[model samples]
Target: MKKTRFHNKYKLIILGVIILLTGCFGLIYFFYRQSPARGEESGDMVAGVSAGALSNTSFIKTYHLRDTTHGYGLFPTKDGGYLVTGDTIAGGGMAAPYPYIVKTDAKGGKVWSRDFSSQSGALGYLSNRHLGRLAVETSDGSFVTASDVIDFVDENLKEIYGDVLLTKLNKNGAQLWSLMLGDHNIDRPRQIWALPNGEVMLLARFLKTGYSSEITDGIPEYSVFIKIDKNGKVQFSKKMEWNATGAERLVDGGFIVLANIAVILPKPAENIVGPEVVPHPLPTMIKLDSDLNIVWAKSMEMIPTEMNSPTSYAGGVMTVGKTIIREAGGDFRVIQAAPDGGFVAFGYDNLILTQGMSSGGAINISDKDVSLRPLVAVKVGANGNYQWAKKLTVNLVSGGSANDFHVVRTADGNFVIMKDVAHDALGVLAAASAVNIGLIKTDADLNPLWVKQYSVERSVEGYGLWPTVDKGVVVAGSMQTTKMHYVMGTSEPYTEAALIKVDVNGDVGGCAAVTTHTGATLEDQSSYLVMQDMKVMGSENLTLKINKKVKEKVNNAKSAARDICKYKKSNVTPIYSLLTSSDGSSPTASGQTVVPSTAKTWAVINYENAKEVAVVGEKNQVIHAELLPILNQVYNSQVKMKDSMASMWLAYVFPRPVTRADVEVIQKNLEGLGYKITGSEGGDLWVSKIGLTLHLEFAIQNSMMGKLEVRF
Candidate 1:
């Protein structure tokens, strides 16, 4: 509290992390060496989660507040319902309740909400509170970009220059037109692309001054790309001295410059500093435009200062385990910029300070600040021009820490990555950094056929992705630790905010049996766990309990959950069942099918997974048989899952013989429940009994890696 670093929550860390990942999540992952099958966290909040490819099901969107602002925005509202924006700082800095925005209706209530002119506090005016990074809906329904920072004395606090400011609501919040964009510097506003022809694209960043004659390029670095139309009018403004963390909007019209392009270089002649630091070549990009006039631009040069520059851009899994920073790690090799601009990146080569050993014994590498690891995704080919080049080799390996992952593109098209992973947990048990949300499924020559892993505890830099209209993958970030419960609190270490839901071949989390993108509503809260995925949704898993042994298991199930179970708030109920097999292709998010009869037994219970007395649900819901055996460890992944249910395994129940009376009835019921066996030999016995056809043969053998064969 006396330090001044990344702040907290935006407001809190992932105390168990959000019910999980308050930010960019993928809580539905699978690896299967063994050990997993835990569910049960019923705080309620589900209306219709289960969509696309075959997992068809929808309807979910109920939680209204608690702390939100990762730059929220999600279109479709001439008025029918839904516009949501973020930043509501609670009772803190800036002014009083700003960045808000609202407009709900498919069912979040509030058909009107606003803040911008400058209230600062609740969610506006910026400075601590939140919200800034573009938000749009304009074309008349009014809703422009750049908010937060409603107060400041001198240099104006620079909120992307605090105010390209524009507000013009109608569905109810009312305001018709309020402008203020560009007076001197700070035009921050990031990402807000929408040009089916209406043209709006604006991925801005301009703090301008110089670059550092000491503290001047205005002190923000550089990154700009504007093109207005919905009434603000800017037309063009393409700049890039090297400093843009993100920029999307390219279904094709143009605009995709995930930034960093400032390679000043030329500092060190000698002066190595203390704890090992050698970096200063930050310039990673993927530019392409037409209006601002940059037909193409692709930079990514390294080997230069201040310890690795291509900073910021992390995906879910909650990172910060400290790889030495430089954006944890990098293996980015995204190509497609060849018209004479030339681009062929195959990057990989970043360690930035290694040296390990922890668990109290000391000597933990110290930390040069930004952390490090990157460089593993190499394989380039470009022709737009040339400049962002790389090629290096030299590593002896002392504690490992390299593969800095996050290069998504999955749900069938191929390419899915998100790893803040750390392997080698074998010996006296030391090297730990377990936050891996990898669902790799490459093809089109991108190689890698199947690689799935999901073990998040904390340390995922920051992200909140969303691209599921019907392909799969609806990630949101924020975590410090989580088992996904909407009112179960704990990670008070950083604060709290986590939200997860992964399904679209990413392999199970919530909503995905094939409807593509329907019903994605996570909404948990104590500190926070929000999700609204209503691009086309439904399913009411909308909890409100505040945790107390889950209101003593809902005052023992029913009886109106102990009269609305108190704890500031409580009221949850929304459960569905669907599973497909026998040729329905591969549907699960509740398609609920069976009837082939070999005994045709299919069950499913939801608990958000992990190892909570209720890890993976519905095999016999006496609340899932009061689950617990380390939550039925199969293949043993310790934990991580959002709501589990699977089916089929009868290869004759599996090789059989673990005999010796199945290790004497699990060593006399885990020594009459004291549980600490260590191993009296004999294994294979994880039967919490999952179904929906073993969750569709574990999502079609994790979407094809095993070749796809699920027939119970």
Candidate 2:
């Protein structure tokens, strides 16, 4: 019996071993078969080629075209597809780019694609091209496209300038008629408005060098209007003394032109340039007759709010500067005729110029301030007088300069604006601009209802937007990607054409788009937590009065408050949330719990955090003498010094360790602040005997400030 039991046990062991080996082999085969499928799935999602139903994911649909393709404009077709226009750089970045257009179905499927390179030139022979701001679908279902032949000179070859290039294409993407309209001088159309009567009006600007005295001399830009019939033949042309930026036809058979006229300030008494007084650019509105005769021109005053004026510098960040006054003007970028017959002009305003170091190692102060470009709106009556103008005070995600590129009047009578923004509001990114695109919806009076921002890793520029047939919005822009090649020690930037369609409610398909609005939590509503009333404990934290709803939610909440605190100057971070009951009951300190970030209602932010190490003046310079005037003059810029402080920090952040070149600017500025360098180490330095030490350290390839201890 024992021998039989041992034999059975041995058979059982052998059977288990066989099953384990078979299972292992099966698992390996399964994973091997699925590898390719997983890789392809990731490629489809990033390539934006999935036939994901438009009705399914409505939040946002991103499309990535071929290498070095840019999308400049988008227009929705009657069949629920979209028509996009942009330039394509084939061959490589060094090759000339050609205008490319695509027609995509509602589901973002490519219906057809056409590249104008073939018509411009043969292969290997590159041809440079520029698409007009947009291509519109004409009343006859065809497309009307315009471009500026750039860098082209006249027969005499005096100067290179852009000439108007127009092309009409049929439904099948075949060119029907191509024409070049301009004199021997520069002529370019900035915008085009398609009329209901099958006619198109071109809002063009021309060089003033060859025109009459009225159109030339003091005026550098002349507003040129050309009306063309369906045959693309000019019916009439008119010119006037206006720096036309944008325009729209009125319902009364007339036109309202949005322009930026130079406000010529009288020459300062110190310098007598009587007739050559420089003009400051300001937003102006001009009403023209059907014959294109200027009836009345109205230039608006600065924003009435105290913060909008320079005198309010001590009160708010919206104020530019007390002494850095430039022209309080903005160029009308986008204009739309309101439903009530009035016209709305949207642009940047309250500009101030500052003096700074130029690349040529020379100090050049700009004629206009580079720090502030508050987007403003001016409402003009039917008769061309200003009704009301106000700043669109919607808090931006990244504080920076923003310009509106497109505006459309929604079916609900509100206005939608598409703008491009950069991250550095302080002009610290050198000359490179553009980071993201923002969409703002405002009422008829220009009050912001809500704002939405869309961004990728790199810069995204919003160029054009149109109302879709489904009452949604179709946006056209460009998305860029970068790749670094270590072998070549170089970086290559590749741009792709991007298109996004949002439903009528500002929702992307079925996904609700994230917006820069106060998401009031249930606790906030029950307790009436007004953000403005939040007590500021210091620069980093704030105290909020917790009600019953907040108390109960805090005990069960996951993490602390993580939403943004929207302020007038900028939207800022809210680092932590410390909750306390109204009855003075404090919750037990426990482990940090994960909380829903979206449910956060409180935000704490500080706007005046200095980017540079603010230097201080000597005791004698502060006690009996004022330092602001001295610092302001020595800095030769907009520097506001208090009674005790004599310095402003530089904008560059210390990365890794500070280098000698980096510390040189700081040392020079400190010397300007009356600080004498008393000691120095490899990369560390000390000034005077005031106990100020700047310790520095170095890594493999970079340096950073190790410690900055200041005792004053």
Indicate which candidate wins on TM-score. 2
What is the Cα-based TM-score of model 1?
0.22
Candidate 1's C-alpha lDDT?
0.32
Off by over 4 Å in 2: 1-66, 117-131, 151-159, 196-198, 209-218, 263-278, 303-332, 351-373, 397-404, 422-434, 469-471, 481-493, 510-515, 519-712
lDDT (10s digit) by residue, model 1, range 1-712: 3212232321133222222221111111111111122111111122333332354212223222333222244443444344545443332222254444555553234455454433332124433222253455655455554553432222334343343454544445555444444324434465565554344665545455422233333225455555555544555555555554554444456544444343333342221112222233333545455443345454332211111111222332222221121221233433322222222233333222121111111222212111222223322233233222211211111121322223445444444444333222322122233233334433322333333344334332223334343344433333333323232353232212222334444444332221111111111010110111111111112111110110000001000000011111112221222222112232222112211111100111011111232233234243223222423432132222323333321111111112344345534654454434333432322222333221112221111011111122
lDDT of 2 by residue, 1-712 (tens): 6544543443354334334333332332232222111010000001111122222213233344444666777777777677777666545444565555676666655666655422223211112222254566777777776555442223333234445655666777766665555543456666676766566777666665542223334466575667766777776666665656677777776777666666545543321112222134455666767766567766543211110112221322222221212223334577788767767777653321111111111222221112222355666556654444444333343222333367888755667777654442324342134456767665565544455666543566667787654445667777654432222344666566667765544545223224443211001111111101111111111111110110000011011111111111112221112222222333222222212122111110000111233334554234213333433433343332211233322122221233465355555666676677765555454665354333322111221111222223
TM-score of each: 0.22, 0.53
Could you list the CA RMSD of all candidates, in the order they appear? 28.9, 27.2
Number of the top lDDT candidate:
2
How close to the true structure is residue 149 of candidate 1, measured as C-alpha lDDT?
Answer: 40
Candidate 1 Cα errors over 4 Å, as ranges? 1-102, 106-163, 168-171, 183-186, 190-204, 207-277, 281-712
**lDDT agreement with native, every candidate:** 0.32, 0.45
Q: Score candidate 2 by lDDT.
A: 0.45
